[model samples]
Target chain A: MAHVISMLPVRNEAARWLRATLEQLSILTDRIVVFDDASADDTADFCKSYPKVRYYRGDIPWFEQNEAELRRHLWELATYENPEWILALDADELFEERATLELPWLLNQEDYDAVAFRIFDFWKGTEQVRIDGAWNPWNRFSPLLVRYDSTLSPDWMAQPIHCGRFPLSYRDRVTFYSHLRVQHFGWARGDEHLKKYLFYRERDLAVYGAVQSHTESVLSSSITLEPWIPMPSPGWFSEKEHR
Target chain B: MKKRIAILTSNHFEPSGARQVYGGAERYGVELTKLLLDMDCDVEWWQVGDNWNKEIIPGVPIRGVPETETPYQTMPHLNQVFFEQAVDADGAIYFVMYLAYPTVFPNSISISHGIYWDHPGMDKFLPSALDRQEWHRRLQLAIGGVRSVVSVDTATINWVRATWPILAQKFSYVPNFVDLNSFYPQNKESRSPHPRLRVVFPRRATTVRGINEAGKTALWLTESHTDLEFHFVGRAHDDNMERTLTTWASSHDRIFYYWLPPHLMAELYRFSDIVWIPTKSSEGTSLSCLEAMASGCAVITTAVGGLCDLIQDGYSGLLIEPTARALADATKRLASDPQLRERLGTHAREVAETFSLDRWHSRWSEVITRVF
Candidate 1:
C-alpha cells in the first residue's frame, strides 16, 4: 500500500470551512497533521476529535507568524511521520476528483517528485470560483503533493503571502495534474469572507505601508459567473463539471 | 450580374523569400483579393512600389504604380491616381493598414487594418515617420468623404468610432475568417510522435510582430522545459531582423527553422502543441492565429488588436501584454500543463469553425453589396 499523509497549518479556523475540508481529506488519506496557530476558539480541541487528524500547536499567534517559516516547519514536521507522500492542504481547501485519479497508483509512480493541482477560488458560495482581478491566483494554482524524499522539499516559499514554499529544483519533476482540482473556500462565507480580505490587507499595510496601491479589490456581490465561458466546477460541492 | 469591386494595397503580397513581400497587411490584402476572386466577383487589384502590370488571375489584372521620386515619400501622387482609377471600378475600398492612407476614394469604404495612435511609438518607424504628419490630415480627409468605415475586430471599430465620433454611424465590424479546410486538426491518436513539445510562432521577422520579445520568452522558457522548441515561420523583412534572430538561434540548440510554405505551414501548426503570436498591434483578425486554432494549437498572444476578440484570457487562449516577461510567464504556464493545452485547443477549434471560409464569404458578399 502507498503510504500517504496530509499536512495543514491553520489558525482561528473554527467556524470557517475547516470541518468540511477535513471530512473530505479523510476519505483520501489515512493520516492528517494540523498545526493550530493559537486559535482562540475550540479549533484545537475540535480537530483532535476527528478519527484520522492529529493536532499540533504552533508557537506563535496566526497573525504574528511569518507564513513562509511556518509552512516550511509544518512541511518538515509532517515528514517525521515517514509517509511516502504528503497531501499538503489549507483549512479552506477541498480536493476534487480528476475523473480517474487513483491516488494509490499515482503515489506508486517513480517519475514525479511533486504534483500540482488546479485551484478554483470560490467566492460567495460553493458554485462560483473567482476569476476576476489580480487579487486571486486567477484560475490555476499549484499547491504541492510532494514525495517525502529528503532532497525534494521546496526551497522557495509562496510569495506575496499565500502558503507553501515551492522549490525551484522541483520544476521539471513537478507534474501539473490540473484534473486534481482544489476548491478554495477562503472567501465565501460569513464575516470570515471580509475578515480574510482585511487580514491580507492588514498584512500588506504592516509590510508595504501606505503606498500599497489599493491592495487589490475583494470579490464584490456585483461579480458573477463569466456568462460567455464555462468555468471549471468547484471541487467542494458535487456540481456537474461545466463543458 | 456580379458587383464590380476594386481592392487597393500599398505593397505587393508574395510569400517571404519570394520576389517581394512585406507585413500582415500585404498578406491579408492578397488573401482577401484571392478569396474574392474565387467567389467569381469582378476584381481589380492595384499595388504601389513597382510599375509592372500583369494578370496573376485570368479576369483580375494587378496594376503596380511606381513610387514618385522623392526622399521619404512613397507614392505621393496615389491620391490623384486612385481617384482616376476608381472611375472605371463600380466601387473602390482602400485597406487602411497603418492608420496611413496612400489613397481614399470618395464615397468608398476605408477598411482599417491598424490604428497608429493605439500603438504609440509606431510612428517612429523610418518609413512611417516620413509621412506621419501626412497620415493625420489624410485620415481626417477620408473620414469626411468615405461612405463608411470597416474594421476587422470590434475593439478596433470601437476605437475608431470613439476617436472619430463623426464616423460612428458609418462603422461596421467584418472580421477576416480562416481557411478551415486547409488548416485543420487531425485525430490526436493518429499523430506521429514528436521528440519535443513544439512551440511555433507564425509571425513575420519584423519589429511589429514582436520577434525580439518572443526570443526573450524562448530563452526564459528553456530553463524550465529543456525539451521545449521554438519554431519561427515567416520571411525576414530586413537584413537586421535576420541577423538578430540568427544570433539568438545560434545561442540555443532548441531554436529551429526559418520559414515554411503554406502546405508545410499547415503541418507545422498541426505538429505544434502551443502557438505564440507576440504582436501588440497591427492585427486585424490575425490569420496566422486563426489558422493555428484551426490546426489545434493552443495559442497565447499579446492582448492587442483583434486577439481580444478571439481569446477569452484563460478560456480558448491566453491574452497577455506584449512584453518579454509577460510572454515568458504565460508560456511557462501553458508549457507545463497538457490538460490545459488540450482543453484550450478543443475550444479554440470550435471558435475557428465559426469563422470558416464559408462564413467569411457571406460577410464579404454583404460588405461588397452594402458598400457599392
Candidate 2:
C-alpha cells in the first residue's frame, strides 16, 4: 500500500472539530504531522494523545505572529515521513468524503505534480448550499494536495499574510483539478472570524501601505450564516452516497 | 459656470486610437470631458500613463504618474497627488474601487465597473486576499467626500448599495454609449456573398470576457460547419492566454485573429455577419453590442449585467446565458438565417444611435451641473 501523510500547521484550534476530523483522516493516511505553534490552549496536549498523529511544538510564538515561518516549519517536518504524497490542510478545513477516495488515485497518477480542488467556503454557518452568487460572492480553486518531492517546497517569507505564493512554473501546466471539494468552516465562530480579519487589516497596512476598511465595515456587509445542510455538487460525492 | 471635474484611471486613456473594451466608465470620462467642454466646463485628466494630453479640454490641465519601475513608488506618488488635489477640484470621478482614490468628494462621484478582488465572490479571479483588503480599505477612504456612487447598470447599483450600505443612497445608474458616426453601418452586400457566415468577437481575449466560451463555440462550429468563419479582433490580457489562443488559432483555418489598434475597428466591423459578446457579469452594458450593432452586424449576447438593458432578443440582438455551449447554439442559429441577421443588425444600429454620445451628454448635463 502507498504511504500517505497529512500535514497540519495549527495555532488555536482546540475542542472545535479537530478530534472528529482526525478520526476521519486516519482512515486514509497512516501518519499525521500536526505542527503546534506554541498555542496558549491545550491543543498540543490534545493532539499528542492521538496514536497516528505526531505533534511538535515550537519554542516561540509563530502561528499568529508569523504565519510563513510556521508553515515553513510544518513543511520541513512533513518531509521526514518520506510519504508518497502530502495532504496539507488547515485545522478548519476538511475533505469531502469523495475527496478521501479520489485523492489516493490522484496521488497515484503521474500526470500531475500538484492537485487543486473546488473550495466550498461555508459562509457563516452553512455548507456548499449557495454557490452561484447566492452566498458570499466567491468560490475558489485551491491547491490542497501535492505530490511529495523530498527536495522541493514553497519558499517561506517572514511576513506573508495570505498563504505564501505557490510556484507559477509547474502550477500552470502540471496542476490537475480534482472532482472532490474542500469544506472550510473558518467563518463559523464570530470571535475567530473577527480576530482573523483584524489581524489581516493590520498586516495589510504594514505590507501594502494602504487599507481604509474598519473591522465593523466588513461585519456590516457579511452574510448571515444559514442552517442549511451541505449540498455539494453532484459528482464523486453523490456517487459514493448511492453505495 | 461650467463644472470643473477630474477622472482617475489606471489604463492610459488614449484620446484617439483603436477602440477596445475600455468600457462605460473609461469612455464616459472622455465623453463627459467633451460634453463639459461644450458646456464650457473645465475638465482635467489625472492617471498613470505614458501619454497625458496636456490640454484635454483646450485649457484644462492633465498629469500622468511617470512610469514607476515598481508599484511601491506609484502608491506614494498617488497619495501625494490625492492629498494635494483632494480639496482643489470641483469634482472627481474614480472608475472602480481598485483605482485607489478618495472615496468621498462633496461634489465628486465614483463609478462601479464590476466586481473587484475584494468583492465577496472574487477570491479566485483576483490575485490574493491581501490585495482585496488593500483595495477594500482604500475604497473606504473617500466614502464621505463623494456626493454619489454611479454605476453603468441597475444590477450593479443594487449590488453596491447592498454590499456597502455606507454608500446606499449614493449609487446611481449611467448607461454607456456608442458613437454611431464612428461605427456606422457598412453596406451589408459588400460583405462576402459566399454562403459561409462570418462572426466577429470584439473583446479583449480574457477569461472574464468569456474567451473560453468563445473557444468552445469556435471549436464546435469549426468541426460541424464549413459555412461559418470566426474572427477574434482584440488581443489577450496576458501572455498565457495569448499563447493559448495563438496555438488554438493556428490549428483552425476557419479562425482569423487580429490584434490591431482601435483606430482600425470602425472599418473592421464590415466583414462580420454577427458579433458575439458572451461575457461575464463583470460588465455594464457591453460596448461590443452597441459597436457591433453600429457597425451593422447582429449581436448575440448573454444577459450578464448592462447587456440586459440593451438587448431585446430577436429585435436588436440575440440574448442567452453565459455559457460556452449556449453561445455555440446561438451562433449556429444566426448562421442559418441571413435575413434575420440583416434585420437585427439594422434595428441594432437604430438602438445604438439612440444611446449616442449626444443622448448621454443631454441626459447627464443637468445632473453634472447639479452635482458640482
lDDT of each: 0.66, 0.64
Find the 10 residues in a row with the least total lDDT in model 1 chain B: B13-22
lDDT of 2 by residue, B116-212 (tens): 3323355543357677566555555544346766666677666656768766676666677777777888675544444567787778787767888
Q: How much does candidate 2 score in TM-score?
A: 0.51
Over B1-372, each residue of candidate 1 has an lDDT whose tens digit, in order, gives: 775677666665331211345345655665677766666668877766456654433335667765544223234465456667657777777766322244555447767664545555544543465476666555565655677766778876687577777666776777767888878886776665556788887888766788888877787777768878888667676534553564456466777535543444565676678898888666767888888888888899877777877877787888888999988887788878889999999899999898787887777667766777
DockQ of each: 0.01, 0.01
* Winning candidate number (lDDT): 1
lDDT for model 1, please: 0.66
Please give, for every candidate in the order listed, the TM-score of chain B alone compared with the true chain B.
0.86, 0.79
lDDT at B27 for candidate 1?
Answer: 53
Which lDDT tens digits does candidate 2 get at residues A180-238? 55677766665666776777678778767765454334455544442333322213223
